[model samples]
Target: MSTKTVAGNYFEDFTIGQEIVHATPRTVTEGDIALYTALYGSRFAATSAATFAESMGLERMPVDSLLAFHLVFGKTVPDISLNAVANLGYAGGVFGVPLYPGDTVTTTSTVIGLKENSNGRSGVVYVRSVGTNQKGEMVLDYIRWVMVNKGNLDAPAPEIVIPDLPGAVAAEDLKVPYDLAGRDYDTVLAGSPYLWDDYEVGERIDHVDGMTIEEAEHMLATRLYQNTAKVHFNQHAQAQAKIGRRLIYGGHIISLARALTFNGLANGQSIAAINAGAHANPTFAGDTVYAWSEVLERIELPGRTDIGALRLRTVATKDLPCADFPYRGEDGKYLPQVVLDLDYTVLIPRR
Candidate 1:
């Protein structure tokens, strides 16, 4: 089986109830760990330093959950969203077990439902995806929906049905890391004035800064996420393998997008629900990441009125902000340098 990529739109080409297995089985590495620490400044002991991890009773540092999620999601892009219109939403997500640096990740999705847009040019598809380690243990599972263009709207619909998904995971379903039961609170490393308190629903934040990635930077990230297909690392692989020249780490884009949300959505620092998210395009080194956000909906949790939920979008770019960064072009294609567009629910303190 050749590993050639899917082209044009994925919509008109898809069949309902079909199970699509995405290409790319990647193995994570230590280089990925170093890059994540330098970029995000996440000091969670389980992921940051080896000594800290063992002190907490773990054999070694584990990978970030965010990193694992993105790797699993990226593998599915070619087959699932090659012709997607826009992502609709997400739900039913659960992270089962922690992933180590050496674990290889591969993903598969089941098409759960389909809905046709009234205009006939586009329709919606829902897929349930699960990520598995090399040992074949399930690490994560989630459902996501995307708007995909129909190859032929005239093609008769197989079934006009949409699967039901929950808006948020029950508190009981959250899998807070066992080793992360306590925190030392290194304010210097965390880089923020806000904490569990001092946030308000509807408030927004802009994390005013940008960084340019290099070919080496993104490859390190992809490898850390254990997405080590030759295309991401070996420049020789690109010429010989025919993959793109530089593979940017998907997490770098995620960090930039999340950081950008700080300006308006900073108050929602404690993320309660992931809701759903996406990497709209492939990012390469030399891309300048920028970010901004809007508060979508607010919800108050029981006995936790001090914090509320805020849904937001974080986008990244290549050079500067694209006049239209995330939208499709007149040719109906994604603009270059717009690496990611993600929607998620975060926790903020009550004003």
Candidate 2:
């Protein structure tokens, strides 16, 4: 056996306040955009057509927000969640400068909290990760916590520290990086008549489409992100496990849900912030995924009249349609079929 091979980090190896600079800085390219579209079938005009993006006041066709997110999030897997049991949730995610083709992104993380599970075999580890472009400007900043396994079961558990995370990203702190001022947005080309002002709080839309995930496709998507999470790829190691199958990467579901939103959210082109998110259940190959969204708030940006923000909660389900909006039980627990609960904000042109 080669001792130089990476064994990955476990629960016992983490400590509060530890800083980790993840490896593999990836440069965004048109190929990545193409593959992302091929995978998720995203049809938003701003990212799909260069001329449309240019007319919208962007310097160039920008990378899809979630694609940029996965690329940066992938870099942290080797050091942060290789032995993860599950990715719990996300919060305070703000997209900064737009990610354009040819821009390179790197990531870094700091451990802020840790707790050993009562069973002593696993514990939750919380980290805040920041992704930056070649110009040293932030592309994305967010916090996420994962349940990780213990390599040394007998190792003494560290002092439990659960970091205080925000319930949501404040509207005022959101960065509106692109200038849509005075730009003529074509609702005809956008594919949706509804704009920011058209939506009222508490409105729910069921995205009436579903995509069945294939094993090979999920593997391809995982490889595209360069995500090296063991549970996603190690089939030989999973044969004896409880699920007995390769776990679908959670990010895959997020992208699928985002792509489905295009039917109703076509004019909601740009994702400005991810207020909060959670992978409620494990997703696997062969699960047919469905999605739906609710308008949580309609926020007006200070001094900006051309655009408005919509705080939305998008829910994803596996092998279950969202026409009835399958979400939680009266006891306040995520339904067994639900896979993702994502709270985010999108920037839409005002009519």
Q: Rate the local accuracy (lDDT) of all candidates.
A: 0.62, 0.91
Question: What does the lDDT read for residue 72 in candidate 2?
Answer: 90
Give me the candidate number with maximum TM-score. 2
Compared with the true structure, what per-residue lDDT tens digits does model 1 show for residues 1-351? 776944544466666788988777878788766676676654443466666555444577777667677777777766776455445556777765677889988899999888888888888888999989998987778888877767776887656878877665655554433332243433333345564444444544454666666666565555444444343555774666355475554556766566455544433433444665666677666777776564555555554533445555555666775333345578876576566666665544443
Residue range 117-185, candidate 2, lDDT tens digits: 999999999999999999999999999999999999999999999998877677787887657787788
Task: Kindly report which residue stretches of model 1 are placed more than 4 angstroms away from their true locations once superposed.
Answer: 1-9, 34-46, 53-59, 85-89, 117-122, 135-137, 149-154, 180-203, 211-253, 259-273, 277-289, 292-351
| TM-score of candidate 2 on Cα atoms, chains taken together | 0.98
| TM-score versus the correct structure, for each prediction | 0.61, 0.98
Deviation in Å, model 1, residue 120 alpha carbon: 4.3
What is the alpha-carbon lDDT for the whole of candidate 2?
0.91
